[model samples]
Target: MRARLELFASIRRDARIEGLSIRGLAKRYQVGRDTVRQALSDPVPPARKTPVRSSPRLDPFKPAIDAMLVEDTTAPRKQRHTARRILARLIEEHDALELSYSTVRDYVRVRRAQIDVEAGRRVEVFVPQEHAPGAEAEVDFGEVWIVLDGVKTKCHMFIFRLSHSGKAIHRVYPTQAQEAFLEGHIEAFNEIGGVPVKHIRYDNLTSAVRTVVFGQGRNRVENDRWVLFRSFYGFDSFYCQPGIAGAHEKGGVEGEVGWFRRNRLTPMPVAKSLEELNDRIRYREAEDDQRRFDGRIRTIGHDFAAERPFLAPLPAEEFDPGLVLNPRVDRSSMITVRMVKYSVPARFIGRRVRVSLRASELVVFDGRAVAARHQRIVAKGGQSVQLDHYLEVLKTKPGALPGSTALARARASGSFTSAHEAFWAASRRVNGDAEGTRELIDVLLLHRSMDAADIQAGITAALRVGAVSADVVAVEARRHATTSAAEGGPRSDRHRGAHAQAKVQRVVSLTQRRLMDPAAVIAGLPSDSRPLPSVRAYDELLAKRAEHPAKTASKENIS
Candidate 1:
């Protein structure tokens, strides 16, 4: 094509500049006169026309093949027509003996695709979208595999991405539940410091969409909680069309999910827990601030810095994305939520308690105070019982402590160490089993007031001194607490370390604290400029009464 065009251009130039004849040009270029005439007429060569070849053997059956292909469109996929089936039908029904299976196979391949294209099944068109600053965002969940706690597990990654700046937030969760969905949005909004002004895009996830209403163009029956969340955040939700048709609607987040999973979570991330994995993912996302999107002049962080002002300011406080459940604490001191049991304090047994079930944790509330909190149980029928919750019960049933499940869990969690076991054994050997276990329980109760490290140090000290008493452990723990506070700024012990409600329950009282700064306290008190409190005036009155007593008695007698 290039050579022919070049020849034509040379011929046309020569004819115009040198005024050569068609025959002369042909003779000079060593070509025929007709070629020189063609070059002179057009500078660019004309495209060669392809002659249509006739499939005479299958030509008569073309209409039948077309009809069959169209019917195949609506037919069950397994029952759809194959080239061999079409040939058999042609021979059996139409008695078209002249047609070969090859003829039918070749025709079916081309015409089937043509039918799909004509019926709008194969071809699709998309419009180029331009997002305005923080006007739009997209959310989706992606599946990622990870080595969690030495077990290979599949996790869902929640992705929230800005359409314009390409700044995205990724959080990995155990499940793609409604709680995680709402929690992801809250985290993303808080991390980004704002919400998209216009709307956030999503696919038809059951978390947000309850029912997808067809034939109305994106109309959806959204989940009630999701609707409330949307209203609270003051953002509209734009649900994409259902199925593969909707994939491109939020292509930004879809691509972002794949990009993150492939690049950041590759080699299957290994972590002890979801929180640890999310920490790593968040750090990687922050590092992504330095990267530029395709065809962009600025980095993602630069664009986000400029776009942040355009976003709607975040709400004053975040919405609590947790489900509140009122479950009765059963005889086991357990509350059943979603078929899983979590232990509360034994005192609450046979009473209903309020529980806030969040994405990762559940909090059992005794009025306004947090009675107990535990990492949520993921498996059905699984139980999460805190040893602290049953300590009061264990105190009465001291023998139960030896074989209790709570004790086993505590030991497994490192909360109850070998030091605790050794101390308990020593106490039991010195005293009876029941008395020794009660003493151990009292020592464990010290954890509520003092830091764990201090309590452990206290246990170590008591064991060294062979005291084997709860009071001794308490005194030792206080000493460690005070020493640590003096050395550091309450990082390990003392006021901040102690569990308190109304005030910091320190190792010493407020009076002792004031004694440390008496001069400052004295300056804060009112100035005492008046003389010392006097009895001299009362004494003067008494003396006058004594002097006038006899005269007063005479006047009284006269009256």
Candidate 2:
């Protein structure tokens, strides 16, 4: 409008200076003659008048709509009548036959706003909270979808936020299981190097809350593990009210969860493995230290530094976050935990073994010793089988060795690499099927005493020389093992010395047997190397000696 006024003024000035007519001024300004005359008369453009619309068809129902709108202010927020409901009620009981839905909708929209303002409904107000450094933090879990190694994966993110510094830690896991919940705390505490203010606030998550007490003011029965955890860390737990009312209690972490996802995990990060994804998350957390929250005068790194000194010093030892279970090894020498099967030693079959289940690992214990450790499998019906666990049983039933799950997993994991495959093929050709499998089992047992790389190197070396026998593979494997031990320098510890001695014994025993075929050794020798001896030759020699004993004696001496 201002530009138009300026243009009209310029045009009038030009007309006065050059003596142009109104029609010429109208054409120059791209306006009508009347517009030019109005512009010349008034220096400012007229204001635009909005069209006045009326809901004539809805006039009879106006009182009812206003009544509903007025009553809605005092009614329950959720129970308030929506426009569609009001429309239905109007058509049903009010006989608003002539009213179109749009007419009623338009009136209701405008009328509700007016009623809300008149009734004093307005935007919510939040108090600016001042948190003491190392005094407060919030915890929450959020869902994240990602693509892992080309497969779509659903994961949960455990978010922790320090109230004072606004420093956050993000860790993702396969599930929001109890173990993961505890593990997230342990990891965050370790990363941050201290526990936040004495009180850590949380929603009434099932992992922490045993049962929520209704009609009580934030009073609830907490899980025993949760109690123990907070006690170990010397912190207090505060449960938020149930549902929407509780969201604001831990608002820092609630907002941080979405904030981190939008800024860092947007577009759904792609990673080959969960560990890789988590490493990336930690690196991002470190990078975020350089940034500051809104309204803060200092960077997150600077704020955290100021708060670090006030934070509760770390415990003398970290808390164990694993869940312990005693699962009996099944007939298959497997123990089921969290619906996933993991193989233990076959000897453990029918016996219960203590299993420690972490978020990413399963460790089996027999008596006080670690029986086996496996990467935890999250998928239902998934199995993590160690080939070494079944070697003893496989030796007696070699037929099962080829199709066993443990063997398949081993092959897939490169533990049973081409070296093992080549050795098995050669052994099968040289020895019968059962015997060859037994020999292979013996070689597999070597993994318990020697490094897998050393064993693989030995297999490659032996295969290079056309040696397929288990004895030959063992000899080569031990040669490498011994060389490795020597290069690793000597150890004085009793356990290490004992292990070294056992390794030496194994190498000596393996090489004590013949590595070459007897038939092959003799195949290249001459066949007719035996002399045509004779009884006649012996008689003639005796007669010559009798005839010329002295000559024979001299010839014998010379010879």
Query: Which one wins on lDDT?
Result: 1
Ten contiguous residues with the weakest lDDT in model 1: 504-513
Question: What are the clash counts of all predictions, listed in order?
Answer: 0, 2
TM-score of each: 0.75, 0.74
Task: Return the clash pairs for model 1, or none.
Answer: none
Q: In lDDT terms, how accurate is model 1?
A: 0.85
Cα-based lDDT at residue 44, candidate 2: 81
Task: Estimate every model's Cα lDDT from 0 to 1.
Answer: 0.85, 0.82
Q: Measured by C-alpha RMSD in angstroms, how accurate is candidate 1?
A: 14.9
Which residue runs of candidate 1 sit more than 4 Å off their true CA positions? 1-61, 70-123, 489-559
